[model samples]
Target: MAHTITGRKRLLARVRRIQGQASALEKALTDGTECAALLQQIAAIRGATNGLMAEVLDGHLREHVGAEGLSAGERERELDQIAAVLRSYLK
Candidate 1:
């Protein structure tokens, strides 16, 4: 199993919610729903997805990057990789 299997499951759940959100948006559009409301829904889904990604990343950091048994240099390298990921995510 992957290191973050639990986290991946949680992320998948969030994504499923987003899928529902998208379906609702689609239905609303088909029914001629207001553009503003659709946009709001899109923004909400985006926020939720970003939050999910953050959770997954945090789990990964705690597991591999910050594993308690790692050597000092290995930990430093992993942390550096994590920092890069954080920077990319921020962008």
Candidate 2:
């Protein structure tokens, strides 16, 4: 998780933005926001989440799957891990 630790501040900033967006969504709902506006908020949240996932997933792949000098077996295991995570995320 070294890559993540190095980028923790940036990632946390993204997470906080998502949190703020969700909070605004809730507030909008309570204030009777239009359907279009609500849908836009949801889309924004999804986009932000996807960006975060992409960033972390890239780091994970670099660290585990594509690290130099890794044995074939280790790379395979990392591939399996990524597959499982992708499966769960897709669901």
Candidate 3:
């Protein structure tokens, strides 16, 4: 969102790090890394991804759903959108 533009750099940095982590995981699989190390890598990736999702979702809740100037209709729309996204993401 435009409100998140201020934090875009930080978000992008997190995404880049996650990309690098995924690449490392790929390389590790190619090299047949140990199971423990592989599990650690996978966990790290999942945690980082969840962190990114939480950050964006928090921003959306604040700027789009919970903002003082937003009408009930607008808030409902934003809530529905986020709920749909949460359902999909959970699956």
Top of the candidates by TM-score: 2
Pick by lDDT: which candidate is best? 2
Taking the candidates one at a time, how many backbone clashes does each contain?
0, 0, 0
- For all candidates in order, the CA lDDT equals 0.83, 0.95, 0.94
Residue lDDT tens for model 1, 1-91 = 2556756677778889989998998998999999899999889888987888777777787788767899999998988988897898789
TM-score, prediction 2 = 0.95
Q: List the candidate numbers ranked by lDDT, top first.
A: 2, 3, 1
Native-vs-model 1 lDDT? 0.83
Candidate 3 ranges beyond 4 A from true positions:
none
lDDT of 2 by residue, 1-91 (tens): 8989999999999999999999999999999999999999999999999999999999988887889999999888989989999999989
Q: lDDT per residue, candidate 3, 1-91, as tens digits?
A: 7757989999999999999999999999999999999999999999999999999999988887988998889888989999999999999
Name the TM-score of candidate 1. 0.71
TM-score of each: 0.71, 0.95, 0.94
Candidate 1's C-alpha runs over 4 A off are: 1-3, 26-32
Order the numbered candidates by TM-score, best leading: 2, 3, 1
TM-score, structure 3 vs. true: 0.94
**Candidate 3 positional error at 40, Å:** 0.7
